[model samples]
Target chain A: MTQSHLAPEVMARARDIVALYPHPRSALIPLCHLAQEQDGWLRPEAMAEIAELVGITPAEVLGTASFYDMLHTEEVGTYVVTLCTNIACMLRGAYELLHHAEESLGIRTGSTTADGVFTLEDAECLADCGRAPCLQVNHRFFGDVSPEGFDKIVDDLRAGRLADEVPHHGTLVRTERDGGLRVEAETITAERRATAAAMAERAATAAAASEAKANG
Target chain B: MTVTDAPKIVTSRLGYDDSHTLERYLATGGYEGLRKALSMTPEDVAKEVDAVSLLGRGGAGFPAGRKWSMLRKAPTSYLVVNGDESEPATFKDHLLIERDPHQLVEGVVIACYALQVTTAFIYIRGEFALGLERVTAAVNDAYGHGAIGRDIFGSGFSIDIVVHPGAGAYICGEETALLESLEGKRGFPRIKPPYFPAAIGLYGEPTVVNNVETLSNLPWVLSNGSAAFTALGEGRSTGTRLFALAGHVKNPGVYEVEMVKTTFRDLIYAPVLGGGIPGGRELKAFIPGGASAPWFGPDQVELPLGQDEVGAAGSMLGSGSVVVMDDSTCVVRAAWRITRFFWRESCGQCTPCREGSGWLEKILRRIEDGEGRESDLELLMDISDNLAPGVSWPPQQTTICVLGSSIPSSIASAIRMFRDEFLLHIKDGSCPQGPAPHG
Candidate 1:
């Protein structure tokens, strides 16, 4: 990845991003974003070119690129599964889910399966502690999984049963105050219809009270 | 408690039963410092800060007063209070901001006056939305009482204070990096030399950055005078520092102590302070300054709990956030957890920090899981060495920030001090130090 090889448009955008900061070298991370956007993954050659563009050494570029899990320094599969295994996720059997993922995919952490379908990596806290045992396939999160359930999810991905319409986990079933389940709608359902009716009743009651006060 | 007996300054403003409301704060001599500062010239105030030699409590330990004096001689210099206390195990700044909002506001006004700046921003942590409201209310109350804004105490100095919440990036705690975040950009730290905040900061004018506690000390210093403020601590590192104590201690909370007066044993073993190790377990290792500072084993426990003393012991008095670990706590687990934090928060700016921290985290994880080779320890050392006290090309003298340097310091020290414990995990393929289940 020589400076000469960068697409002229990508190089221009990288330069512009670097120029935003007072010091150009401070733009290293953002430039990597530009490079990744251009090349899909951070190639060593592209990183070297970015280093030259940002007035830093290639080693520095490589270091910054590899530091974050989000940045893909190598080729990745079409779908990326990032599992959150920080303290909260760990307490909720995230490790079981991770192991299940490896077994299903026939690939270890940091590797893409031979089928070129999925890439898996252990992620840090994603700020979704409320929904423990969560994993994000690309941009969507699949939360609250048992070991067998996680295995089924990977199988569904492998089978193409779940279409890639922006990968998402199932609806989050929140625990209500009285220890009952309150399922918020991730998909349109009869339960969602009941919730809507209850909300409408409350709104009508408030409106009627306001109307009565105006008449008085 | 008598002033001499009670470690004065940082915790002086903290009361267990104190309400954070403006009325409660005012009833307790909160605005006295602001009044005293308003009565004097800004230059005189700056000079007084220079006299006390107070340092920033946000890890760097840069002299607070000296920082104020460095602001460009412009009509509109800015004072930014760094309340982004993002270091793991550091919670003292949040306590002051939440429990004593007016005290922080008073400190801000005094600092703004000293720097000859009418506009100030409290760069708060994004997660501290509750804290933001408390500070905002305090600022409004001060305005209503003429303690801030135009014609404060009949003085011509008018100060406007605003709370700017950050997007919760740990790197923003660094002074230069903080300035970048405040400008509504990604919180990436800029290299120094070509760009120092004092000269070209926050819209390319002069800006003064002070820690929340450092600014909070301003009002007291202005009221008591420099000599009195300096009298409280040792030479050079004058004034009181807030130490946030946590982990395995019976009574873990923030304590205010003079810089040179406190000892490690007194702080940790004193029943009212940290209450020694929990459940009578012997102390194994301790982190003196949040997660970034180097770890100290039991043999190093006798070292005094002061800035100079701690630094001489090959660690820092960073933010004064002390975390203690007992015998049951696995050193390997602790190192792995702290390394993971750095890896997650690396910002991916510098190569050594980004790649090095992730590698270290992965290696530590491997060691904790009993899959580590003997050479893995050597590899960890090599990676950490590259991250700290080493020059990088483009010739940046140190790691990208103190964060990069400090993360490795804790890991390397933990490995050096407790190799047997780490080796046990590798040999047994399980954590022998894992805590027993509660009844």
Candidate 2:
């Protein structure tokens, strides 16, 4: 394996990441992160370089990189749409959302679109189960997404409207109030609250029922 | 009424009407464990833990007290609480961390005080943002109350608790891999021997890595003494285990019980446990441990649920996460989903695990999708056999880590218990259980 294809900046970042760990070989993960951040995907030569930088054999680096689901080893589209398909999300139409995405994009899960603009992959629980049927475009989350809503977002992205980057928690809406900046409190609509409460209640009921059956 | 017996090990003081709150914890004598531990000699504390024979809650089941004893020789020791809780079907640690953060915090303090460590880290899963916040708040409260950080309780014992969030990697749940991530790197678990965390761990200092539930048991052990803790369970495996029950159960959550006291039938038929399968359906099979263990079908002896019994049955009581499968579940499909999970999360460190997991996943997926080859079933078995224990990989040919062996154990168990089900998937071109979504 060759180790000379990496950009100087990428190498510098990898070196910095490697320095963060006491053992250089332990830096393989962070170095891969830097490689992904710079090149958008882990190339063969880059992986080899990471192995050399981390003081491990190329095969060892490849082995570590391939075990995790999140690390992208191959080339991906400009934007990656990762859908959460864990149990919590599965109950909330995540399957339907995934199917809708596959249909709309004309690409299967783990495959990039023909245009090379989007790649769809199924992810484990994204911890946003409170708002299920969620998808992430480049690390930004779009929660409580319906099929139509997802299609609209994809269409917007296709038309070049960059998805707004927001924090996972806290409010997204900001407003100016009398010469000062004010962040809008998240409004819990009656309908949304009712739906959320109902979901919680259903989960509790299911849990109780499961416990009862187990004990009985 | 006078009760003279020793208290239970894990749940001796836990589970009294939603007593997860800090106030309730204090009222029920929670932090007293830490106080009691702080007054004891570190060596004596380690001995007591060793004598009790408590094991790791994270699938491996290594003796906890022995692991702590191994860390005693390191000059600057650190205690790491493995809060990753990433195993697919396991949720006990999540409950312990989310519902009882202070108890875990108290345990950390006790462990640190015993080991004479100055710092502790909680490497929580990135998906557990809420859990992270809860634990971080609890740690802050402990610091505020002078229970943690510089000179805790004026005993000259200082410890700092740092919450390191993992970037959603299942493999990092392994201790060495967690240390890598804590050092601001990607989370790849290291092969043992030369890289065991105890000796050459975390910047080359002695480190003690324990599961969240294992550490949570520390306070009780400290307060009640080793004899009391050991009295709860059968020989060797002492204490209560928090079984995270799920799938086809009337109730699916964390339940604390004595290690060997509960039976498989008791957990299944008991209305408060698993509700005897769903809709009066017969229990077809169950993953006695987490996703990594082998499946036990109805034909298998319905024995007591414990480490010894489960191990004797050729599976482990891993993480105490019992995932039940009813008659409605197709074993082949279950195996496929589980193989897919391993393939997706293999960490790709070894060829047998990385390539073999992918192969198993592909074969199982094809079989599930009605694209079966007659030889694929045998091929699946072959691949699994290659990854099984005693099998070696290239460079050494022997398997590197438990991650490599876990999937094979599961696949073999699935095959042995449900061979007919696998054959049905290949012959009928569809699951006999039909097209229902698995929970």
Off by over 4 Å in 2: A1-121, A125-216, B1-24, B389-397, B432-439
How many residue pairs clash in all the candidates, one count each?
A: 4, 37
Report the C-alpha lDDT of model 2 over B1-439, residue by residue, as the tens digit: 1112334445544456555566777787868888877787777887888888988888878898778777747557778889888776577776677678888999888888778887777877755545665676777667767788777787887777766555568778888878777764556677667645778778668888899999888888888888878877787677778777666666655667776766777666676555566577778787787776777777553666567777877778887777777776666766766677777777766898889888888887778777788998778777877787432221113356677777766667777777787788788987664542322
TM-score of chain B of 1: 0.93
TM-score of chain A of 2: 0.71
Number of backbone clashes in candidate 2: 37
RMSD of 1: 17.3
Q: How good is the docking of model 1, as DockQ?
A: 0.03
Error of 1 at A120 (Å): 20
Instruction: Give TM per candidate.
Output: 0.67, 0.72
| Top-TM-score structure, candidate number | 2
